[model samples]
Target: MASLLCWCLEAVLVAVLAVVGGVSGQVEAATPRRELVPAMFVFGDSLIDNGNNNNLPSLAKANYYPYGIDFNGGPTGRFSNGYTIVDELAELLGLPLIPAYSEASGEDMLHGVNYASAAAGILDITGRNFVGRIPFGQQVENFKNTIDRITENLQSVDVAQALARCLIFVGMGSNDYLNNYLLPNYNTRNEYNGQQYANLLVQQYTTQLTRMYNIGARRFAIAGLGLMGCIPNILAQSPTDSCSDQVNQLVQPFNANVKAMIGNLNANLPGAKFVYIDITRMMKDILVRPAAYGGQITCLPFQTPCPNRDEYVYWDAFHPTSRVNVIMGRRAFNGDESIVYPMNIQQLANLDLQPNNG
Candidate 1:
């Protein structure tokens, strides 16, 4: 699974994968009446930012219009039309939809807080185009504040044990590519080649992840970057009407490094269990046979979206449709080594992480 590098970059590559049946399956979340973990603390970009960016002055807002047409509240700042992958994951974990840090308070903070923001990234400069964003460091900083609040309420003595049993889920790095390096306005592309850039991202990410581990995040499900080139936003701009092999090529190293990071963390960190969710493979499945889940559409400004949005693989130019989100959630929750890697989330959740108490 190192690379789809040699494969030809054709729109019909989708058809090719479908015919070969390299990856195919529909995963549904198993309803669990019992909670898998005591809580979940999420961190990432728009892919799971429930509603953190609504009031931000940034242009990455998704609060209005046909955005959340299918969701319960209708446009709750989720990038998708319905449930986000995190929302589905929380449900599968038998927990309520984790609230955004900007909105959650009091008892809501006890379960978890979603610190994901629309334009956030591993690098601080990664999403400056949006003008205002809580970078990954800031998101972790926000979590620190939440931790302090929890410490005050329940006392710091009990907080460590609680956090040890909670799930720390993160799926980021897309915006670092989509919003920064690829943009003409940014200097990131000139500063480094793809591998160097990926290395830089992983380095900073390793620091933040280790910081979380030090703060009592013991169980982790870290999602790797997906098929950036195949998402409709990049596809529509491709010169060949196919996925941009260039963009996908740029992203491969990041996923590889992240998988390596998981192994390093598992070996070195005594009390933590880290699992890598191979979203690249799962997304390839979605794009390989998008028709299996839904159809495709061309976006037009101020236009009403397809009434039957459930049939489209993308909600808009940049994000996956809710059905695809559900598929990703299921894959992360219960998928095998091919997709989840090392170990899947279900096994990670059940893993006995004994406290390092003498």
Candidate 2:
């Protein structure tokens, strides 16, 4: 009887331990994973641009004081006070921040390179106001150059395969609207209506993204245009300091077409995992409830480092504050289907791609 009791106690203890261990295992499993992708290849405008515009003879350059005040490397040409969207995304990916294509050398190209330039857009003439910006086409060319350099360092096939696995981020189009269509000096508006212009932009965008696919990019996280009318720059344009509903309406078609484009790309491009990031919705959410998201609606235009930078959503009339950028990055990284359709960047990164013919 005593032996039987002792055996029963042992069994109960084992059961308890097993239960406890299972709970502990569940807790451990709940922790977030890291480094969903091998590397991140960024291509966009000022939103994700790090320092590509620094050396260029352009008014859009942001490599100066107050720009990188919050960054470890001061004044690294990020338009925001610190940590652009790409910076935060890289941190979430467990990779070091990607260097701008202009500055990246030798080992810098190993992980990836950022070809985004401040004021850059899909159209070559989009940022003509800036005078010397690298448009989306030239950025792609720079990326091709980077690929050649990578091929020289590593085996061409290995580089190609690695690129197939990397995350490709594109966040253009906003500049196309803000710097080209809306500019008083530009004739884009005279040439096309909102619908026609959006269609034209999508047509060009499709070609550019296809070129990226031809060059081996498979996983894509493309950010749609945000609510340009709500930015301080546009808001200031209003005599009553109100948001421009007209400007906001103008870009809706672009966002809609971009969603359609993603669906089409996924259907047509084998091995393509295109995730559409709804910047329009994301920005509106933050703007609508600025207090909840820890953001302010406005900031002084073109001023040196606002002391209360954290409170303002607009860092300087145009760009979002670093805090807002961090929040935006987090949402883009792991947001629900509502914000990031099909999947988020995290999902895109972890998705298994089929064997590519390339």
Candidate 3:
């Protein structure tokens, strides 16, 4: 009886220890919920550009007047009359206004930075017709150089880690087709149709995105081609006030394929989230039904509602107005089943509990 009692006590003690250990392990395994901070880093072409290429000898630049006329009633180097998508995104996040990366006096480095060029594209050859367009490789190099400068300038900085937290916004590829292949000088349309062109562009983009991922970009907002066919520049080619079905046909597949590429990238890269914005469809919706958006049918005289710039389509010929860009950014942030989705930049930022009150 004594021996049996001793054995039973030992067994009870072991069981008690095991239970305590298990509970302790579970407690250690629990992770605290992370609060999302608003730190956007934009890099792309004119649609969301903030004048990174103003000084660069590229014809893709928009540092002149009339571009930012709507911004502060003066040129701010942004391609739009007012704020671009990145600027509005900063406001939505409640962060301070995003400054151009080129600004010598405004290099805060913490809030956000804009590195978009006017006519830059994924392919180096795309902007040949655009006078002085910078290539994707050159842009990437510049981005890296900027990061280095930031690290050297800031004290107690983990340059690699800071970049990981910064949201990378990249929009390219439009010029690759529009100015390079489709322009009168090149016109690859006669050889490779729209689908083929899109595939080529996507392949080039995949390489560039991979390079970015390798360079400490964990958070990304990768925008695809906008309504290139509907732009005033392309539409002017039609001359009859009709839409450019040729450009539209090419653009449709390009957006779809680009979205697919984003999905694939997300799957392949662990913990990488890439959101594709369908600005083409959104732009079309406004153009097809201007009254639905609460805007008039004509923006100016002599131009028909469609021509006059009713809420119908474009602002001038090349870009959307600042208001539309804000809407597009919001939609892109939100995601599918949203206004357009996989959540636009605005909606994604909302998921973060951190303050972005810019």
Candidate 4:
């Protein structure tokens, strides 16, 4: 009886310890963190756009109803129903939400500036169908203008050092595929095959990125194209109502080239550290369990979206919900090799990339 009592007591103690450990782990995760980097400069399309397109005369605007339904500040021109991936990423970095270049000024420009615009692409003519949108080439020019403003307050050397310490995230190429090549209005398909186009984009992209490095940027996180075929808009066009495999296969070359480009950039550019964000891999698990999320793929413009936004995957045919934004942001912040090549966002932020200043 004594031996049995001792064994029972040990089992009870083990269970109690396990419960306490689990609770403590949960609390630790909830703990607030300090800012990781000085600032984060964001550049991309509607996937990350936050109101830069609102004042533009582009037909690609999303500053209404279904778009900012979940946002604290309504209709911020983000495609999704609230916080974008960049917003979530800013939160993860313990930084305030970086303001759009259009609306940001004075102290707002200090933390960071988002240059992403709806319908923007790596190529100048990619989103012509939408008209009045800022292309990637012009966005870089806009950044130079921003640098001038930032220089007004800080010394030129200080501006360079601060920018080098900051994180520069650029997610391009989606519009290059969806709007430029695939659309009948554009002759991109006739001019170049998938491989050729990917090559052309990467070639141009190389120059744009080099310009960034020449100016000040040092730590970079370049986001690759995700599963564009898997988007609901693509699905709606599919006769079988499934992900278009052909479209998925077409963008692989672009993603692959971008990865190779990162390797080349890291090898040649001094003080430049660039990591590729594999968005396709980031969405893999979420894609497999579509049932857990609301099965709806497309949400019409101006129409009300699904009730439980978290349960939905695609906020609309093109963008993702706030739930996905947070998940992708968290993954990029801490995910392993499969998600972000060479290093992750958190690691990039921690890099002591104090520029030479010479």
Model 2 per-residue lDDT tens digits across residues 198-307: 99999999999999998888999999988888876776568876779999999999999999999999999988889999988877676664333232232222344455
Tell me the tens digit of each residue's lDDT in model 1 across 95-154. Answer: 999999999999998879999998889999878878777899999989889998889888
| Residue 278 alpha-carbon offset, candidate 2, angstroms | 0.5
Error of 4 at 327 (Å): 0.4
Of candidates 3 and 1, the better by lDDT: 1
Q: Which stretches of candidate 1 lie over 4 Å from their true place?
A: 1-32, 290-303
Evaluation by lDDT, superior candidate among 1 and 2:
1
Query: How well is each residue in 222-304 modelled by candidate 3, as lDDT tens digits?
Result: 77676666565654456564557777777777787888888899788765667776667666554553323322222221222
lDDT of each: 0.79, 0.77, 0.60, 0.78
| TM-score winner, 2 or 4 | 4
Worst 10 residues of 1 by lDDT: 1-10
Candidate 3 deviant stretches above 4 angstroms: 1-38, 104-107, 153-157, 292-313, 335-340, 350-358
Whole-model lDDT, candidate 1? 0.79
